[model samples]
Target: MHIKNKLSVAIILALTLGLAGCQSAYYKTMESFGYHKRDILVSNVEKARESQEEASEQFKSALDKFSALTGFHGGDLEDTYERLNDEYESSEAAAADVRKRIDAVAEVGNDLFDEWKTELSQYTSSKLRNDSRVKLSKTKSKFKKMLSAMRKAEKKIAPVLNVFHDQVLYLKHNLNAQAIASLKSELSNLETDIGKLIAEMQRSIDEANAFIKDLKKQ
Candidate 1:
Protein backbone atom coordinates (compact mmCIF):
# COMPACT_ATOMS: atom_id res chain seq x y z
CA MET A 1 0.00 0.00 0.00
CA HIS A 2 1.08 3.55 -0.74
CA ILE A 3 1.92 5.84 2.19
CA LYS A 4 -1.25 7.88 1.74
CA ASN A 5 -3.33 4.71 1.76
CA LYS A 6 -1.43 3.50 4.84
CA LEU A 7 -2.13 6.77 6.59
CA SER A 8 -5.81 6.57 5.74
CA VAL A 9 -5.99 3.00 6.96
CA ALA A 10 -4.26 3.96 10.18
CA ILE A 11 -6.70 6.81 10.78
CA ILE A 12 -9.66 4.53 10.18
CA LEU A 13 -8.21 1.77 12.35
CA ALA A 14 -7.54 4.16 15.19
CA LEU A 15 -11.09 5.44 14.97
CA THR A 16 -12.44 1.91 14.80
CA LEU A 17 -10.39 0.85 17.81
CA GLY A 18 -11.61 3.85 19.79
CA LEU A 19 -15.16 2.93 18.88
CA ALA A 20 -14.63 -0.64 20.07
CA GLY A 21 -13.42 0.62 23.42
CA CYS A 22 -16.41 2.95 23.66
CA GLN A 23 -18.69 0.01 23.04
CA SER A 24 -16.85 -2.00 25.65
CA ALA A 25 -17.21 0.83 28.13
CA TYR A 26 -20.94 0.89 27.59
CA TYR A 27 -21.18 -2.84 27.94
CA LYS A 28 -19.23 -2.69 31.16
CA THR A 29 -21.45 0.09 32.42
CA MET A 30 -24.55 -1.93 31.67
CA GLU A 31 -23.12 -5.01 33.34
CA SER A 32 -22.39 -3.06 36.49
CA PHE A 33 -25.92 -1.69 36.44
CA GLY A 34 -27.31 -5.28 36.38
CA TYR A 35 -30.00 -4.34 33.93
CA HIS A 36 -31.05 -7.28 31.82
CA LYS A 37 -31.83 -6.57 28.16
CA ARG A 38 -32.46 -2.88 28.65
CA ASP A 39 -31.80 -0.58 25.74
CA ILE A 40 -28.56 1.15 26.59
CA LEU A 41 -28.78 3.22 23.45
CA VAL A 42 -26.50 6.06 24.56
CA SER A 43 -23.37 4.40 23.23
CA ASN A 44 -24.84 4.09 19.75
CA VAL A 45 -26.02 7.68 19.88
CA GLU A 46 -22.55 8.85 20.87
CA LYS A 47 -21.06 6.81 18.05
CA ALA A 48 -23.43 8.45 15.62
CA ARG A 49 -22.44 11.88 16.86
CA GLU A 50 -18.78 11.03 16.42
CA SER A 51 -19.47 9.72 12.95
CA GLN A 52 -21.27 12.90 11.95
CA GLU A 53 -18.49 15.10 13.25
CA GLU A 54 -15.87 13.12 11.34
CA ALA A 55 -17.99 13.15 8.19
CA SER A 56 -18.57 16.88 8.47
CA GLU A 57 -14.84 17.48 8.65
CA GLN A 58 -14.30 15.19 5.70
CA PHE A 59 -17.04 16.96 3.74
CA LYS A 60 -15.52 20.36 4.44
CA SER A 61 -12.02 19.20 3.55
CA ALA A 62 -13.32 17.54 0.40
CA LEU A 63 -14.71 20.88 -0.74
CA ASP A 64 -11.23 22.08 -1.64
CA LYS A 65 -10.48 18.78 -3.31
CA PHE A 66 -13.79 18.82 -5.15
CA SER A 67 -13.16 22.29 -6.49
CA ALA A 68 -9.66 21.37 -7.57
CA LEU A 69 -10.52 18.05 -9.15
CA THR A 70 -14.01 18.71 -10.49
CA GLY A 71 -14.15 22.52 -10.71
CA PHE A 72 -17.05 22.51 -8.27
CA HIS A 73 -17.35 24.60 -5.16
CA GLY A 74 -19.61 22.83 -2.70
CA GLY A 75 -21.38 26.19 -2.37
CA ASP A 76 -22.58 26.01 -5.96
CA LEU A 77 -24.08 22.61 -5.21
CA GLU A 78 -27.12 23.58 -3.14
CA ASP A 79 -28.66 20.13 -3.01
CA THR A 80 -25.40 18.57 -1.93
CA TYR A 81 -24.88 21.29 0.65
CA GLU A 82 -28.40 20.62 1.90
CA ARG A 83 -27.48 16.95 2.26
CA LEU A 84 -24.51 17.90 4.42
CA ASN A 85 -26.71 20.20 6.49
CA ASP A 86 -29.16 17.38 6.97
CA GLU A 87 -26.35 15.23 8.29
CA TYR A 88 -25.48 17.98 10.77
CA GLU A 89 -29.06 18.01 11.99
CA SER A 90 -29.06 14.25 12.36
CA SER A 91 -25.85 14.46 14.37
CA GLU A 92 -27.44 16.97 16.71
CA ALA A 93 -30.37 14.67 17.24
CA ALA A 94 -28.02 11.80 17.99
CA ALA A 95 -26.18 13.94 20.53
CA ALA A 96 -29.51 14.69 22.18
CA ASP A 97 -30.19 10.97 22.41
CA VAL A 98 -26.82 10.48 24.02
CA ARG A 99 -27.60 13.11 26.65
CA LYS A 100 -30.92 11.51 27.42
CA ARG A 101 -29.30 8.13 27.77
CA ILE A 102 -26.58 9.54 29.99
CA ASP A 103 -29.22 10.97 32.28
CA ALA A 104 -31.00 7.64 32.42
CA VAL A 105 -27.80 5.80 33.26
CA ALA A 106 -26.85 8.35 35.91
CA GLU A 107 -30.19 7.87 37.60
CA VAL A 108 -29.20 4.23 38.06
CA GLY A 109 -25.65 4.76 39.42
CA ASN A 110 -22.27 6.22 38.58
CA ASP A 111 -20.34 2.94 38.80
CA LEU A 112 -22.71 0.57 37.03
CA PHE A 113 -20.58 0.21 33.92
CA ASP A 114 -19.42 -3.36 34.59
CA GLU A 115 -22.91 -4.60 35.44
CA TRP A 116 -24.14 -3.14 32.19
CA LYS A 117 -21.65 -5.24 30.25
CA THR A 118 -22.65 -8.44 32.01
CA GLU A 119 -26.33 -7.76 31.42
CA LEU A 120 -25.73 -7.14 27.73
CA SER A 121 -23.67 -10.31 27.41
CA GLN A 122 -26.60 -12.41 28.60
CA TYR A 123 -28.72 -11.36 25.64
CA THR A 124 -26.13 -11.39 22.89
CA SER A 125 -27.09 -13.87 20.20
CA SER A 126 -24.87 -16.81 19.31
CA LYS A 127 -25.00 -15.63 15.71
CA LEU A 128 -22.86 -12.67 16.70
CA ARG A 129 -20.19 -14.99 18.04
CA ASN A 130 -20.16 -16.98 14.84
CA ASP A 131 -19.93 -13.85 12.72
CA SER A 132 -17.12 -12.35 14.78
CA ARG A 133 -15.23 -15.60 14.77
CA VAL A 134 -15.14 -15.50 10.97
CA LYS A 135 -14.10 -11.87 10.69
CA LEU A 136 -11.53 -12.11 13.47
CA SER A 137 -9.70 -14.86 11.60
CA LYS A 138 -8.29 -12.42 9.05
CA THR A 139 -4.77 -11.01 9.41
CA LYS A 140 -4.46 -7.27 9.97
CA SER A 141 -3.20 -6.72 6.44
CA LYS A 142 -6.22 -8.32 4.79
CA PHE A 143 -8.58 -6.52 7.13
CA LYS A 144 -6.94 -3.20 6.31
CA LYS A 145 -7.28 -3.88 2.58
CA MET A 146 -10.96 -4.68 3.04
CA LEU A 147 -11.49 -1.51 5.01
CA SER A 148 -9.77 0.49 2.27
CA ALA A 149 -12.07 -0.98 -0.35
CA MET A 150 -15.13 -0.05 1.66
CA ARG A 151 -13.74 3.44 2.14
CA LYS A 152 -13.19 3.90 -1.60
CA ALA A 153 -16.92 4.46 -1.99
CA GLU A 154 -16.54 7.54 0.19
CA LYS A 155 -13.90 8.98 -2.16
CA LYS A 156 -16.50 9.37 -4.91
CA ILE A 157 -18.88 11.13 -2.56
CA ALA A 158 -17.98 14.67 -3.60
CA PRO A 159 -18.45 14.17 -7.31
CA VAL A 160 -21.53 12.05 -6.80
CA LEU A 161 -23.08 14.65 -4.51
CA ASN A 162 -22.22 17.38 -7.01
CA VAL A 163 -24.03 15.44 -9.70
CA PHE A 164 -27.05 15.06 -7.44
CA HIS A 165 -27.05 18.81 -6.96
CA ASP A 166 -26.89 19.39 -10.72
CA GLN A 167 -29.73 16.98 -11.23
CA VAL A 168 -31.93 18.87 -8.78
CA LEU A 169 -31.13 22.07 -10.67
CA TYR A 170 -31.86 20.30 -13.92
CA LEU A 171 -35.22 19.10 -12.60
CA LYS A 172 -36.23 22.60 -11.60
CA HIS A 173 -36.12 23.70 -15.25
CA ASN A 174 -36.78 20.47 -17.11
CA LEU A 175 -38.99 17.84 -15.48
CA ASN A 176 -39.11 14.43 -17.17
CA ALA A 177 -40.26 10.99 -16.01
CA GLN A 178 -37.02 9.35 -17.07
CA ALA A 179 -34.92 11.88 -15.15
CA ILE A 180 -37.07 11.51 -12.04
CA ALA A 181 -36.82 7.75 -12.26
CA SER A 182 -33.08 7.93 -12.62
CA LEU A 183 -32.81 10.21 -9.61
CA LYS A 184 -34.86 7.86 -7.46
CA SER A 185 -32.78 4.92 -8.55
CA GLU A 186 -29.52 6.59 -7.68
CA LEU A 187 -30.86 7.84 -4.35
CA SER A 188 -32.21 4.41 -3.50
CA ASN A 189 -28.86 2.82 -4.24
CA LEU A 190 -27.11 5.34 -2.01
CA GLU A 191 -29.57 4.62 0.79
CA THR A 192 -29.12 0.88 0.40
CA ASP A 193 -25.36 1.13 0.42
CA ILE A 194 -25.36 3.30 3.53
CA GLY A 195 -27.78 0.97 5.28
CA LYS A 196 -25.58 -2.01 4.50
CA LEU A 197 -22.50 -0.32 5.91
CA ILE A 198 -24.28 0.57 9.15
CA ALA A 199 -25.59 -2.97 9.54
CA GLU A 200 -22.15 -4.41 8.88
CA MET A 201 -20.58 -2.19 11.52
CA GLN A 202 -23.22 -3.14 14.05
CA ARG A 203 -22.50 -6.79 13.36
CA SER A 204 -18.80 -6.18 13.72
CA ILE A 205 -19.44 -4.54 17.07
CA ASP A 206 -21.50 -7.48 18.22
CA GLU A 207 -18.74 -9.81 17.18
CA ALA A 208 -16.16 -7.88 19.13
CA ASN A 209 -18.35 -7.97 22.23
CA ALA A 210 -18.84 -11.66 21.77
CA PHE A 211 -15.09 -12.09 21.75
CA ILE A 212 -14.88 -10.16 25.01
CA LYS A 213 -17.56 -12.39 26.46
CA ASP A 214 -15.55 -15.45 25.46
CA LEU A 215 -12.58 -14.08 27.31
CA LYS A 216 -14.66 -13.54 30.43
CA LYS A 217 -15.88 -17.14 30.23
CA GLN A 218 -12.27 -18.28 30.37
Candidate 2:
Protein backbone atom coordinates (compact mmCIF):
# COMPACT_ATOMS: atom_id res chain seq x y z
CA MET A 1 0.00 0.00 0.00
CA HIS A 2 1.02 3.61 -0.52
CA ILE A 3 2.41 5.40 2.53
CA LYS A 4 -0.41 7.96 2.60
CA ASN A 5 -3.06 5.26 2.50
CA LYS A 6 -1.31 3.39 5.29
CA LEU A 7 -1.32 6.52 7.41
CA SER A 8 -4.99 7.04 6.70
CA VAL A 9 -5.73 3.51 7.88
CA ALA A 10 -3.71 4.13 10.98
CA ILE A 11 -5.73 7.26 11.69
CA ILE A 12 -8.96 5.32 11.36
CA LEU A 13 -7.64 2.69 13.71
CA ALA A 14 -6.48 5.28 16.22
CA LEU A 15 -9.90 6.93 16.12
CA THR A 16 -11.62 3.62 16.56
CA LEU A 17 -9.37 2.81 19.49
CA GLY A 18 -8.98 6.15 21.26
CA LEU A 19 -11.54 8.65 20.05
CA ALA A 20 -10.90 11.34 22.68
CA GLY A 21 -7.14 11.01 23.24
CA CYS A 22 -6.26 10.64 19.57
CA GLN A 23 -6.21 14.36 18.74
CA SER A 24 -2.44 14.83 18.64
CA ALA A 25 -2.01 11.43 17.03
CA TYR A 26 -4.83 12.12 14.61
CA TYR A 27 -3.18 15.40 13.61
CA LYS A 28 0.18 13.76 13.16
CA THR A 29 -1.28 10.95 11.07
CA MET A 30 -3.15 13.37 8.84
CA GLU A 31 -0.04 15.51 8.50
CA SER A 32 1.93 12.47 7.46
CA PHE A 33 -0.76 11.77 4.86
CA GLY A 34 -0.09 15.26 3.43
CA TYR A 35 -2.84 17.26 5.19
CA HIS A 36 -1.36 20.32 6.85
CA LYS A 37 -2.45 22.15 10.03
CA ARG A 38 -3.74 25.17 8.13
CA ASP A 39 -6.04 22.93 6.12
CA ILE A 40 -7.38 21.33 9.28
CA LEU A 41 -7.76 24.72 10.93
CA VAL A 42 -9.95 25.96 8.10
CA SER A 43 -12.10 22.84 8.29
CA ASN A 44 -12.49 23.20 12.06
CA VAL A 45 -13.44 26.87 11.76
CA GLU A 46 -16.13 25.94 9.27
CA LYS A 47 -17.46 23.31 11.63
CA ALA A 48 -17.59 25.82 14.48
CA ARG A 49 -19.47 28.28 12.28
CA GLU A 50 -21.93 25.64 11.16
CA SER A 51 -22.53 24.59 14.74
CA GLN A 52 -23.07 28.16 15.89
CA GLU A 53 -25.51 28.74 13.04
CA GLU A 54 -27.46 25.64 13.97
CA ALA A 55 -27.50 26.69 17.59
CA SER A 56 -28.79 30.12 16.61
CA GLU A 57 -31.62 28.57 14.64
CA GLN A 58 -32.51 26.17 17.41
CA PHE A 59 -32.71 28.91 20.02
CA LYS A 60 -34.89 30.95 17.69
CA SER A 61 -37.17 27.99 17.26
CA ALA A 62 -37.43 27.58 21.01
CA LEU A 63 -38.34 31.23 21.33
CA ASP A 64 -41.04 30.85 18.72
CA LYS A 65 -42.44 27.78 20.41
CA PHE A 66 -42.54 29.53 23.76
CA SER A 67 -44.41 32.40 22.15
CA ALA A 68 -46.89 29.97 20.75
CA LEU A 69 -47.34 28.49 24.19
CA THR A 70 -48.26 31.91 25.55
CA GLY A 71 -51.08 31.97 23.02
CA PHE A 72 -52.02 28.42 23.88
CA HIS A 73 -55.60 27.78 24.93
CA GLY A 74 -57.80 24.83 25.84
CA GLY A 75 -56.41 21.90 23.89
CA ASP A 76 -53.88 19.16 24.78
CA LEU A 77 -52.00 20.79 27.65
CA GLU A 78 -49.74 17.80 28.14
CA ASP A 79 -49.03 17.67 24.45
CA THR A 80 -48.07 21.34 24.40
CA TYR A 81 -45.65 20.95 27.27
CA GLU A 82 -44.13 17.95 25.51
CA ARG A 83 -43.50 20.00 22.38
CA LEU A 84 -42.03 22.95 24.28
CA ASN A 85 -39.91 20.61 26.36
CA ASP A 86 -38.64 19.00 23.19
CA GLU A 87 -37.62 22.38 21.85
CA TYR A 88 -35.85 23.21 25.09
CA GLU A 89 -34.02 19.90 25.03
CA SER A 90 -33.07 20.39 21.42
CA SER A 91 -31.81 23.90 22.09
CA GLU A 92 -29.71 22.60 24.97
CA ALA A 93 -28.22 19.94 22.76
CA ALA A 94 -27.46 22.48 20.03
CA ALA A 95 -25.67 24.69 22.54
CA ALA A 96 -23.61 21.74 23.66
CA ASP A 97 -22.72 20.97 20.06
CA VAL A 98 -21.56 24.55 19.56
CA ARG A 99 -19.22 24.28 22.53
CA LYS A 100 -17.91 20.96 21.27
CA ARG A 101 -17.17 22.44 17.84
CA ILE A 102 -15.35 25.40 19.38
CA ASP A 103 -13.23 23.02 21.42
CA ALA A 104 -12.32 21.10 18.29
CA VAL A 105 -11.24 24.31 16.58
CA ALA A 106 -9.09 25.23 19.57
CA GLU A 107 -7.52 21.79 19.65
CA VAL A 108 -6.49 21.91 16.01
CA GLY A 109 -5.30 25.48 16.45
CA ASN A 110 -3.16 24.57 19.46
CA ASP A 111 -1.72 21.61 17.61
CA LEU A 112 -0.87 23.87 14.71
CA PHE A 113 0.84 26.36 17.03
CA ASP A 114 2.89 23.72 18.82
CA GLU A 115 3.98 22.28 15.50
CA TRP A 116 4.77 25.73 14.16
CA LYS A 117 6.91 26.54 17.22
CA THR A 118 8.88 23.30 16.89
CA GLU A 119 9.39 23.79 13.17
CA LEU A 120 10.76 27.28 13.87
CA SER A 121 13.66 25.67 15.69
CA GLN A 122 14.66 23.85 12.50
CA TYR A 123 14.91 27.03 10.40
CA THR A 124 18.47 27.86 9.31
CA SER A 125 17.52 31.47 8.61
CA SER A 126 16.83 33.45 11.76
CA LYS A 127 14.92 36.10 9.80
CA LEU A 128 12.36 33.62 8.44
CA ARG A 129 12.01 31.92 11.82
CA ASN A 130 11.50 35.21 13.62
CA ASP A 131 8.97 36.32 11.02
CA SER A 132 7.07 33.06 11.41
CA ARG A 133 7.12 33.44 15.19
CA VAL A 134 5.65 36.93 14.94
CA LYS A 135 2.83 35.66 12.75
CA LEU A 136 2.12 32.81 15.16
CA SER A 137 1.99 35.22 18.08
CA LYS A 138 -0.48 37.42 16.24
CA THR A 139 -2.67 34.45 15.29
CA LYS A 140 -2.70 33.18 18.86
CA SER A 141 -3.79 36.56 20.17
CA LYS A 142 -6.63 36.78 17.66
CA PHE A 143 -7.69 33.24 18.48
CA LYS A 144 -7.81 34.03 22.20
CA LYS A 145 -10.10 36.99 21.60
CA MET A 146 -12.35 35.06 19.23
CA LEU A 147 -12.58 32.10 21.56
CA SER A 148 -13.58 34.39 24.43
CA ALA A 149 -16.38 35.90 22.38
CA MET A 150 -17.62 32.46 21.41
CA ARG A 151 -17.64 31.27 25.02
CA LYS A 152 -19.41 34.42 26.16
CA ALA A 153 -22.22 33.72 23.72
CA GLU A 154 -22.27 30.12 24.83
CA LYS A 155 -22.78 31.21 28.43
CA LYS A 156 -25.81 33.24 27.38
CA ILE A 157 -27.63 30.06 26.46
CA ALA A 158 -27.69 28.75 30.04
CA PRO A 159 -29.87 31.49 31.50
CA VAL A 160 -32.27 31.21 28.61
CA LEU A 161 -32.39 27.49 29.12
CA ASN A 162 -33.17 28.03 32.78
CA VAL A 163 -36.13 30.22 31.86
CA PHE A 164 -37.42 27.60 29.47
CA HIS A 165 -37.03 24.88 32.05
CA ASP A 166 -38.97 26.86 34.63
CA GLN A 167 -41.83 27.51 32.24
CA VAL A 168 -41.94 23.94 31.09
CA LEU A 169 -41.96 22.58 34.61
CA TYR A 170 -44.62 25.07 35.67
CA LEU A 171 -46.80 24.05 32.78
CA LYS A 172 -46.25 20.39 33.57
CA HIS A 173 -47.65 20.76 37.09
CA ASN A 174 -50.33 23.40 36.49
CA LEU A 175 -51.67 22.57 33.06
CA ASN A 176 -54.76 24.67 33.54
CA ALA A 177 -56.28 27.96 32.44
CA GLN A 178 -54.83 29.73 35.49
CA ALA A 179 -51.29 28.63 34.63
CA ILE A 180 -51.75 29.92 31.08
CA ALA A 181 -53.00 33.23 32.37
CA SER A 182 -50.05 33.62 34.70
CA LEU A 183 -47.63 33.02 31.85
CA LYS A 184 -48.86 36.14 30.06
CA SER A 185 -46.94 38.41 32.41
CA GLU A 186 -43.85 36.27 31.92
CA LEU A 187 -43.92 36.74 28.14
CA SER A 188 -42.12 40.06 28.28
CA ASN A 189 -39.23 38.61 30.24
CA LEU A 190 -39.04 35.67 27.88
CA GLU A 191 -38.93 37.96 24.91
CA THR A 192 -36.13 39.99 26.45
CA ASP A 193 -34.06 36.92 27.26
CA ILE A 194 -34.53 35.51 23.80
CA GLY A 195 -33.52 38.82 22.27
CA LYS A 196 -30.37 38.97 24.35
CA LEU A 197 -29.53 35.37 23.53
CA ILE A 198 -29.91 36.01 19.80
CA ALA A 199 -27.85 39.19 19.97
CA GLU A 200 -25.01 37.39 21.72
CA MET A 201 -25.20 34.57 19.20
CA GLN A 202 -24.91 37.03 16.34
CA ARG A 203 -21.87 38.59 17.93
CA SER A 204 -20.24 35.21 18.28
CA ILE A 205 -21.02 34.41 14.67
CA ASP A 206 -19.47 37.67 13.57
CA GLU A 207 -16.34 36.95 15.56
CA ALA A 208 -16.11 33.51 14.06
CA ASN A 209 -16.38 34.93 10.56
CA ALA A 210 -13.79 37.61 11.20
CA PHE A 211 -11.39 35.13 12.76
CA ILE A 212 -11.84 32.66 9.94
CA LYS A 213 -11.01 35.32 7.38
CA ASP A 214 -8.07 36.56 9.38
CA LEU A 215 -6.44 33.13 9.69
CA LYS A 216 -7.19 31.57 6.30
CA LYS A 217 -4.25 33.58 4.95
CA GLN A 218 -2.00 31.27 6.94
Which residue pairs in model 2 clash with each other? Answer: none
Please give, for residues 1-218, the per-residue lDDT of candidate 2 as tens digits.
99777877876865564366866666676676676778777777788888888988888888888788778757999999899889989988998898888887887788788888889999999999999999989988988887888788878888888888888889899999776776677878878987887787788778778988988766
Candidate 1 lDDT, 11-104, residue by residue in tens: 4554465357664444444444442222332333244334434444443443333233233323444454445345434434543443443343
> Native-vs-model 1 lDDT?
0.42
Candidate 1 residue-wise lDDT at 175: 40
Q: Pick the candidate with the highest lDDT.
A: 2
Poorly placed runs, candidate 2 (over 4 Å): 1-18
Candidate topping TM-score: 2
